[model samples]
Target chain A: MNDLIQTGKYLLIISAIAGLLLAFTEMVTAPRIAENNRLVLEKARREVLPGAERFDTLDLATTDDAGHPATRSLSLGFDAQGKFLGTVQTVSPKGYGGPIDIVLGLKPDGAVSGVKIQSMRETPGLGTKLAEGFLDKFLEVARAGHPVKFFVKKDGGDIDAITAATISSRAFCKGIRDGIKVVQEGQTLIQQRAAAPGATPLPGPATTPVAPSPAPAPAPAPVVPPAPSVPPAPPADPESPPPAPTVAPEPPAPPLPPAIPQGGGQ
Target chain B: MNTKELTKGIWAENPIFVIMLGCCPALAVSTSLANAFGMGIAATFVLLGSNLIISLIRASVPDKIRIPVYIVVIATFVTMIDKFMAAFTPALSASLGIFIPLIVVNCIILGRAEAFANKNTPQDSILDAIGMGLGFTIALAMIAVFREVLGDGKFFGIPVPLIKDDPCLLMIMAPGGFFVFGLLMAWKKHLAAGGAK
Candidate 1:
């Protein structure tokens, strides 16, 4: 019993010292660690929303397709003259390995401006192809103002899923679709804030009415003129105008109906 | 202080080969040269720090609770390196992943603390750490180079033409690690035997 008490005292002293040392180290490194994280997020934002002169964090509430609240915020991109360019949203959808965090930039009219994968634990060579080849297709469809489809050719959608990484590919598509839904649901409020400069858009309380019908059709027109103007100026542009139109209507093709059921069952 | 304590870990008491300590990380992170080197350096930092501290406090630590005290000391250093890596070298930190934290449980560290540090002077303990750490790093690098060149057909991500185009993919997988580790161990044993003769 005497020896036990002595051992207990020694253990307590060592643990207390260890705890104090760790606390000191944490205090010293916390700020720098936070700064590193912010820099990574900032770089991802810039990559996703290229050509934006500046970015502003907009406090906007987002909801899922089921109208349940989802945690997402919009980063508003503006040109040199403060013209509203587009918005960047972060979405994490369930991927094969784990949650794949994607940073998506969308034009005010619901087109994809760009996509940058922020973080993912997908298989090194296979699922990781989503960052390399697979993302380009989504960017192409979004640039053309087409509804995004989230499946591969085997499932009857336009996307050629990553070889042997169909699940990861589908997860990528799901994240993109979820992001687009957020932009669509919050479109009216975003446009209102964009049009009325200096107006603080309050986070609406529960049951914020889905804007009345016919809003989606007219919303694309004003945003469309600016979209074409920026892409054509450089002759070096890879995604030229002609191919976009041909691919734009493909998302609305019969493949979508069959793809939905297959994705659901899987 | 005796120079034998420092020189022994380099060859005779080599951590990975002869001593055969800390093999879990040796196999797991040895897939890439860069990853292997990073794990090596992080482990070295923890080993050196823990050994020095344990040596300094060896007299005061009671035999009845020495293991717990040593663990607390080692864990403190591991946490420090883990945070420092995350802040300064985020990419390396991400690639090394769980192995960085696992350094706390690495047997080479605790073994040294028990075998060498507890009985040695601080200066001797520091040298032992440096020698053992370098041996571990070199061993891991050797294994990494073989695996990477054969498995991925790349030496540090630079593709070799014939091998890169058609390489044995198994070298980067779990079975590949075991194969290389066994071969390397046998080769080291052969070299030691020849040297002795």
Candidate 2:
């Protein structure tokens, strides 16, 4: 009993010292770790929506096709002149191994501006292809046009699936589709917010576009003017100084979608 | 300070090959040269810190409670390294993933604390820690060189000339890690056996 007491005291003293050191280390690194995480999120935002100089956090509240009410938060991107550029939405689609966190960018016209996989736990060499060559292919399709039928070719959709990692490919497609829907849901609010900043009357060439009817028109969805489908110019470098404000100011505030139709039937 | 204590761990009692410590990380993180280097340096830092502290407290630590005390000291060092790396080298920290935290359980650290630091002078223990840490790093780099070049057709992510386009994928997988580890261990043994003379 006496020896056990001694051992306990010894362990207690050692643990106290260990705890103090850990506390000190945590104090020193906590702020830096938080800063690093912010930088990572910032970089991902820029990667997905290149040329976006500033971002405003916005929320999208809607019910999915299955009527499950979901709330998604996104970043509204704007150029230096406060012209609305796009929205960056993050979605976690169910992947083969787990939830794959994907960040997607949608132009004011509802076209996919860019897509990036933020984190995943899929098979290393196989499902992990979602981030490699497959990402480039997906981006190409996104830039090709709006209202992309985001399904794998095997599913009678346009995108090509990674040969052996079809599940991850499917998840990528689902993530893109989900992001578009959320941005569409929040389209009206996004436009209002975008317009409030510049406070400039809509230019004669740029009329308030007819808000898209909130009906579930998955294809040819989002009726904002084609805006010449100006492809989102790839930001030269994500880590470099912000792009020059000389961005050819596209007509600000693409049309707003009409009132969100509650529980629009699938 | 005896130089033999330091030199012996480099080859004579090399941690990874002869003593066979830390093979788990040796195989898991050896998929690339960069990962090996990161893991090696992180583990070495932890080893050096743990060995120094344990050796200093060797006389005062109660015999039965030594393991717990040593663990507390080692864990403190590991957590410090993990936080520091995450803060400063986030990229390396992300690629290495859980392997960084798992270093807390590496047999090498606890093994050295028990075998060398507990019984040796602080000065000698420091040398032993350095020697053993280098041994682990060298062995891991050897396996990583083969795996990355053949499996990924790259060295440190730079494409190797002839093999860059078409490389065998299996060399970077778990089976590949085991295969390379066993082959290297055998080669080391053969070299130790007088090189077929």
Candidate 3:
């Protein structure tokens, strides 16, 4: 009976101390952890869309232009003049391995500002390539120079495919294309309301219309190298890219196409 | 109850190689030297705190609910370490993911409290705690060195010769972890046998 009583007493005391320590730990570090996450997210937002001094977030209803339910995002970025610079929103797409989380940025026009790959447990060398190639496509795609609707070659858009890692290329391609479609629809809605003969319109970026001609033909073969190697686009060459570098930084690794190589852009 | 008790944990009762507790973090985070170091420090904090408190109450604690009591004590330290890691080393914390919380049941600390510290003096318990922690750290570091070099073809993120340039993709995969662990275990056993012979 004495032994039992002693044991019970010890248990109670240990339990009380444990509870106190745990509460103290939670109190001390909870705020710091929260701050760290916020800081990192902000950094990622900036990297995804640079040149914008400050930014805000928007709750884009996941409803597609068709008014169907889907994954919506809280958009982040800054407004530079009438144009929304660094406009970024995260989108998750299921890849061959797992869900790939991507941040898509849009410049003033409906073109891509850049892409930030936030999370992926992709196969290291192969699937990981998707996160690296944002620049060539971002600059060229964001320019909206080509009147043709943007599509990754797999979807028949002119965008070239990464050589071996086709699936990652397609996943990234789909994400950027879908993001463009969403932003354009939003812009159109804003424009429609403003152009009404009597009404002063609400402010927003002008939406680009989805082209009647759909994304270009698919790539069954002839893995065209990405823009990094494509004879420097005549203007914004990364080798000596112009003042406001049109090319986003490539992934640290060497360019994709085994055959054609460029000056190592360390 | 003095230094010997503590020193024993560093070698004889080393958690990773000898007792085989907390193998998940030992292998998972041991991919990089930095990660291994982070894990080692985190585990050490938990071990030291838990052992100290558990020893303080060993005399009073009732046998009926001792397991539950120990769990609560262990959990408190785990939370402290987890929170500290998150705040101070957010990058490492993010990389470690769920492994930090799992330290609660790391048999090394709990096992020591139940076996050694409960029976020993406070000073001895603390030493044992420190020793065991160091031993675990060294084991993890050794394994990480092998894994990072062979797997990613890098050491502490710096590229190495031939390997990093045109890597052998296998070392980074899940199977590679098991391979490294088994080989290390065998090597340790061989060394021990050789020393004895």
Q: What is the Å distance of residue A83 in model 1 from its true position? A: 4.4
Model 3 per-residue lDDT tens digits across residues B140-185: 8888888778876789878898888776556555567778888988
Q: Per-residue lDDT of A1-266 in model 3, one digit per residue for the tens? A: 98777767776676777777777877887898779877876777777777654454333333443445554443434333323353577776666557677777765454566677766655433455465444365456545554434455676665666544567666766666666554443332222211221222323433222333332322222222222321222221123223112322322122111210111110
lDDT, residue A118, model 2: 76
Per-prediction DockQ comes to 0.37, 0.34, 0.37
lDDT for B46 (candidate 2): 82
lDDT accuracy of residue A261 in candidate 2: 28
**Pairs of colliding residues, candidate 1:** A112-A142
Score chain A of each prediction against the true chain A by TM-score and list the results. Answer: 0.63, 0.68, 0.53
Docking class of 3: acceptable
Cα lDDT tens digits, model 1, A116-147, are 88778675445766876578765675465345
TM-scores of the models, in the order given: 0.70, 0.74, 0.64
Docking quality tier of candidate 2?
Answer: acceptable
Q: Which ten residues in a row have the lowest lDDT in candidate 1 chain A?
A: A253-262
TM-score of chain B of 1: 0.90
Candidate 2 lDDT score at position A248: 25
